[model samples]
Target: MPREVMIHPLAPAGEPIPLVLVAHGSRDPRAQASTRALARGVAAARPGLDVRSAFLELAEPTPAQVLSALRAGGAPAPIVVPVLLTRAYHGRVDLPAQVAGFDCAIADTLGTVSEPLLAGLVRRLREACPEYDAVVLAAAGTSVASGRATVAGVAAELGRRLGVPCEVAYASAGGPGGADAVAALRAAGARRVAAAAYFLAPGRLYDTVMSDALQAGAVGAAAPLGAARELVRLVLAAADAAAPQLALTAA
Candidate 1:
């Protein structure tokens, strides 16, 4: 028997269960690369699993478009794994609205702040700079209490686990933005401040925020959390959570 490779959404055959990796796309090359790398990592973790990637906005393969493409290709069911860290516009409103009538499973956002994720974050922090006069656990920021709580909890836990003084800062929410991370640390009497980027990808927002902030005397900007091995597991867990235990076919 001969097997064929299905790349396009038009390709048909078997009820392939598509694990759609959904990310908030950015113009930054790093962000784009991170999304692709994460998708690859997920597929690697689940060898036989049919995994794919899409963007929430500012990129290609929107939810509806990807779902339509997959459905057209005759996939049995597709699960949407939001690569978002917070339940902001994309996770809370945009994603739901986009996939309202779609024939697929919508998994929770990838911001579960799992133990492995926290561990990985801590490890990255350690690697970024040895001395954290004051560690500012930063995030994209959100108005939703639940969303803020999730990231904040992670930061608090990380601080406790790592045994350091950690505080939450936002880069996009306009409150205590990343641009102020260094300033806050300096004000707090930090000798060498480190901005622990609580982000998944790098982009204009991240670059500008960190660049201007670092110039203000912060030691260094820790890399964004993306495509790490633990990240793959987190996304898969989300997919499994969204999937029905009974495995229903697309109607």
Candidate 2:
């Protein structure tokens, strides 16, 4: 039996552009699943648009492979949107190297601090536990100075939003780890400390933060920003911003 193609009512009249969302791959299957789920959400929101997910490594369909396939399929003007949370090494160096010869435009990495992201954090924190005296923003740390700065800025912004002091902690590579941060809060007489997952997916880093922080006296740890509607909107917004870049590339 032939299936009828159902067009989305809100779909644009003309051919929609393809969006290649490239995520930092993980060894944990949940990371890949969450990445795909986020892409699915974006595709659902903008029905006619071609939204695809690819990884950096430790996963199938690397970004290069996806881009090559898109080029071979005669995609005239596709764009690559990094599913990364910050403009760190991956976004600054690796992604460009991957799409070097490809004609597709690359959108900006999702910034550290945004209204939608803040709301997502609040939602996750509330779901994890009740109001706490302190919060720690747990991130996958990087040696890059700018990357650390980005996380710090986000922690500050989150603190403002929650009207509570929020400290930045690292899961790998850099400074005060989740356990350390939580312990500091506990030592300072904080009866209840919550750690917010300043990450995109569930993986080794996130798991470490949750487990270690709780062991170090944190009351709870929020879930990763997986498949959040706000994240989907951010991805789509990134793609739209790059639409004009296609014209510039053609020129």
Candidate 3:
């Protein structure tokens, strides 16, 4: 995709600062489609907000490029909300670097997991399978200690929510892949194990874990959390959290 600003069609005169949703770009075409769908959902949920989407890498309209365009267009400073589920590489490293010299309000990443997010996961899991001995929350997996910790935290929360033993597994770049985790659950006497994809969209990692988990004895694996209304609300909240910062920037 070309580097361009996606302004909302209903943007009013002297609109508040724009909301830029920064997603970890993917090479897969479906990834872009998912991201755009998510942006559209956000825009629909809050028609008065000027919501736009950008990529951190492997896609166009990067954070830096978006900032440049916003500045050139005489737009007010934007509130950048990372569409990441964790505060790992993209959130901690790439985002800061991209907006380092720019004037924008940067919100924290969505987090390892949250209630709204878990709702989406649970919805997917229920749709995939009705019965399961154990649940595995499978993330993309990051080598960063903080990222791993976030995943673990989310797993713990998910365990509480489901009232089941939830294990944290990685799809890549980490240890204990989904297949292995599910297998361990089975070895521990679980007859049915289901894997819940922690990914935001369908991509290589999502596909890998979905295949591995199912092949490794998992009865079923939930689909990725793509453009779900729960996620749309979460993204809007992230952008809203940066409102104070946006006000400061405009001042």
Candidate 4:
């Protein structure tokens, strides 16, 4: 867990602080584009607020670059929001190291189980498969045990919400892949099984998982949470919780 930083609701007496979203960058251009789209959504949702996107690796505009530009522009210490779904290596180690020298407060990860995030998953799943007896929540795998536990929690909550059995699967790293999960659900006598993408953006991993799920008899696979309204709200909420006084009202 990250150390809590005390922020007085009335201390910052100036313009709204900038929000820098730091993502675990990918080599795929689609992933980068999706991150930029989310940043635009944040800025559009809150006019006059400075919203920027940075990457931990494999993409342009690293955290250091963004923070340096902000410092040069005389902007106050900003909140660095990690656009990560789980508190894995990237959130717990990589992100902290990347933004270590910056005079900025780090907010919590988007997390595995949040109301807005769950809703986004459901919305995407429904759009992909209107009817399914079972679902598979496919995530970009993490080696951290705690991170895997959180993914399971999210799967349980999603199952409860959708009134269907949901299992957690991984696209890489360790754990059951999408095909295995789908096959397991079928073996348990499920007629239709669909996959709900637990990714913030589209990339090769996502494509591979969806393909495997479909090949394993999944009905359909939902798209990633790219610029979804629910996701935009979640980002704003994270920013608000980090800096109360500079919280941008969600649209």
Candidate 5:
């Protein structure tokens, strides 16, 4: 049989679906737990989707393991939903490699300018600390060319939404660090800037980002989109995209 051949379900269209929610796992248990929460939230919103969480690395249930589970369960088709915020190595290379010879399409990552996503952050910021004058989105830098593009894309969207300049910075890897973002805000004439750490959970990176941004004169760091309802919508959108062609499936 040729590769990329997805099996059809004998069950009706209204039947539930099997899905894999992939994440760029971390050594931090909170990170793993957060992904688990995302999968669970997706499942809650759409009971029709059988969501499963898997890590790209440094966590259990790798993509290969997820594929095995799907195949063993005899799922007609399984959609791979990446929990990543950007299309870096895990999204471009590691993810595709898992399904290269296998059957299934991958959904897009949690790219920056998510309308509901950004709104969610705004709301969270307003509730937590309304004094902030600007929002700074910070992520771990990646050497990949596409990674920078992803951040730029998100920053542009955010910039448009807030009616103020939104900036991007990195906590590590190659990047314009968070401090750089603060400087840019200052240069752009922003008086008070808030840091929105894009990290999923608490760990060394998360601590470093928060500490540095706050010390660098940021108002405060907003919460990560951990189990946010808007994020669930984005995840579902990705799932629908990767699911086999069916006009009724999205309904």
Candidate 6:
């Protein structure tokens, strides 16, 4: 009793489809710079592929602006990849509303617990502290239950991969902040606790969490996963998977 789905070529004769990486925008300059860097990395990985970066809010060149420019340049409907790690508010509502008028295929949000993404987290954590017995996956918390669940899942998997107990902490919204999480881990008999930033770019929330963690006796905190090689791979994979759907939608 299910409908069948058809996949089509991205263009009339298999022309290259533009990929737009949409990030949760921030007012912080570092956030914008980090996103632009990610766009560059994606562009570099696929030599001739068109890769563009746009923000959903609090940043320049919104998704609509990017799509309009692409249309003006005679490019076909693009595959919009939400560079989000979870299907939170931005991914679920804001992004869809932003691109509603555009004839583009909206790809799935880059999930939290992808292998490459976990690998990137490990890489960043290790780079921050060579040895740590425990970690706290600090995230910009969301009130949505599903989003919180995804973040918790990421924490468990990350802990398993690192062979340490990882706890989930929030930087904003409603939850235990980074300091409290670090304190809990310490009281739970974790000798050396580190905070792994569950963010795609450097922003106010990330800064606050990292600072709080460090102040609360965390050995060190990993930086945001900005322009990391693993992230680049994930972005490309998302675009490729959505290309056919985008073509179908455009048809």
RMSD of each: 5.4, 4.7, 5.0, 5.7, 6.4, 5.3
lDDT of 6 by residue, 1-251 (tens): 11212222357657678889999989898998998899998877776678899999898899999999999999978889999988989999999999998889888888657888898999998899888989999998899889999999999999999888899989888768988999999999999999998999998999888888999999998989999998987887787788778656656
Ranking by TM-score: 6, 2, 4, 3, 1, 5
* After superposition, candidate 1 runs with Cα above 4 Å error: 1-16, 245-251
Candidate 6 residue 69 Cα shift, in angstroms, is: 0.6
lDDT string, candidate 2, 1-251, tens digits: 12213332221225567889999999999999999999888888876668899998899799889988877886666789999988889999998998888888899888667887888888888899877989999998889888888888988999898887788888888568888998887777778899998899999988886787888888889999899887876787777777788777666
Tens digit of lDDT per residue, candidate 5, span 62-91?
Answer: 888878878787775567888887788888
TM-scores, in order shown? 0.86, 0.92, 0.91, 0.92, 0.85, 0.94
Error of 5 at 183 (Å): 3.0
Clashes of each: 0, 0, 0, 0, 0, 0
**Candidate 1 per-residue C-alpha lDDT over 106-199 given as tens digits, one digit per residue, 9 for 90 to 100:** 7788776678688668767777887775777777777788988888888788778877667777766666766576677677777877777778
**Local distance difference test, each candidate:** 0.74, 0.83, 0.81, 0.86, 0.73, 0.87
Off by over 4 Å in 3: 1-14
Worst 10 residues of 1 by lDDT: 1-10
lDDT for each residue of candidate 3 in 59-133, tens digit (9 for 90 to 100): 988988888888899877788889898888789888999889998888888864677877888888898988987
lDDT for 188 (candidate 2): 77
Q: Is candidate 3 or candidate 6 better by lDDT?
A: 6
Q: Say which prediction, candidate 1 or candidate 3, comes out ahead on TM-score.
A: 3
lDDT of 5: 0.73
Stretches of candidate 2 exceeding 4 Å from the true structure: 1-14
Clashing residue pairs in candidate 6, if any? none
Task: Tell me how many residue pairs clash in candidate 3.
Answer: 0
For candidate 3, the lDDT comes to 0.81
Quote the positional error of residue 35 for candidate 4 in Å. 0.7
